[model samples]
Target: MIGTPRIQSLPQGIEVGIKALAARCREGEKRIAAALRELEAFGYLQRVRDRLPSGRVITRTIFCNQPTALLRPRRPAPARPQASAPNPASEHTGPSEQPAPEAPAPLPVPPPPPPLPQAPPSVPLPPSLPLVPPPTAPKLPPGPIPRPDELTPELDRAATALLSDLHRRAPQFTLTETDVRQLVPGVAAWLERAAHPDAIRHALTDDPPVPLKRPALLLKHRLTELLPPAPPDTQELAALTHRPRITVTPFQTCEDCDRAFRSPTPGHCRDCREHRAEDLRTAA
Candidate 1:
């Protein structure tokens, strides 16, 4: 009997399955498979197939908790003695000189170990088909749904996948096609507004309902209720756009030194202008 999937409490005699191993290792199925292969190659793990009386085949993966057990070589089993065949002439003379050698009986074999426990059934993912209208917001706080700097086909796909996979975490949120279609717009709205896919998932999945008859409606309701305000950049951009625009004072080129000046028409630059003004003052 495997207790919990925790590594610290792994059952002594019971063999752990891939799922339990994954939980213990804190890894996904692919990583667990790779590690299993390495361990098996290094003699730390072994997989055996067993056929039950019910005609069902199951695979058992055994783990060697104490690796040092492999280092010590096991003593070979003792072989039984075999009796020699008797000659026909010896059989006739038998009673006096032809005493037959005694044969040791065969050793009894032990029965095979019992089959492993069956794995749990896998859950189905929610609908992922394209949204009918993507999703519209009910009434969220105002600002902007700051769009991505470089939008890609990937963002929408990721959002859709996140919504579709929600059922895996919460069984109550088994979204149908119509639900996905309806809720997708709200998710899209969140993503466009710079919300992370994970954040969106958390907001929608946090504290799931017990007897959820309509997942889409609840999600739709959350779409507006839990909707976050516009991101910082959007706020900054709004601030900038709302500010007054400044007008520029055009400059003209000086006829004397090719220098630019802010005047209707200047014969020279500031130095020349000051010089002319000083000379005119002296002459007066």
Candidate 2:
């Protein structure tokens, strides 16, 4: 019999299959199956098979709290007695009675079927088919691979000039050939974007937005940010010609103070020009 706690713990409503019940109870499948059979025997659980209209048979489980009425045992039917052979001595009193007919001999049993053929133990199995290999990608046309020493004279000249300028401005931050090699790619990128060498120099020398711990890392970041916009495509340029052109102000740099400023003038900064005028007036 199932314990009260266990019976109470049994899931209600929808049926949880045998595997689920076994998992929940932490018991083996055979043990859970036997337990369920015992419960059914005690009339605690009833299993009913239902045949659907689709010809599919499904077993339905019903739980009962109260014990059901025990079924009566079925009695075996009495076997009929077989006829015995007639006695030869009893035939003398009745001479007129005909002799009993001889019984027919039993038929012989058929021979057993032939044994099936089995494979030899020493024979090896046939080799399996080889797997198909994956398709190879199409070969692409090879282009010239860029090397550090193979840079064009113009690019090489620009890289050297930038390195020399950096050395002249900040001698304490000396760069090695390896450092120059690493920095060349960034300089090349800036050049490719149509940035002037002078502008690259200015950006490198200017006070960084953040303090630099490593010159190489800081220079790389500055070059990336200062990369100029690419030239507009021919199609875009043609499209823009039809639209009204908007005038844009050009930026200027002071020749005397070397400070960048927004102005229509070409040479000295406003402060430098003002100072020069003041000095001239004082002299007069």
Worst 10 residues of 1 by lDDT: 104-113
lDDT of 1 by residue, 145-183 (tens): 224444457766765787889989877788887667556
Return the TM-score for each candidate structure: 0.30, 0.30
Residue 179, model 1: Cα distance from true site in angstroms: 1.5
Cα lDDT tens digits for candidate 2, 1-284: 23335765766664644676666777777877787788778766666555554557777665545443222222333343455788777666555666565443322222333356886788677988557544674555533222332467788778767875686776544677777777786787667666787788778767754445577666766666666667788899988888888777677989999988877767887899999999999999
Give the clashing pairs for model 1. Answer: 134-185, 135-185
Candidate 1 stretches greater than 4 Å from native: 1-153, 234-284
**Model 2 misplaced stretches (Cα beyond 4 Å):** 1-151, 209-213, 242-284
- Tell me how far the alpha carbon of residue 273 in candidate 2 is from the true structure, in angstroms, after superposition: 62
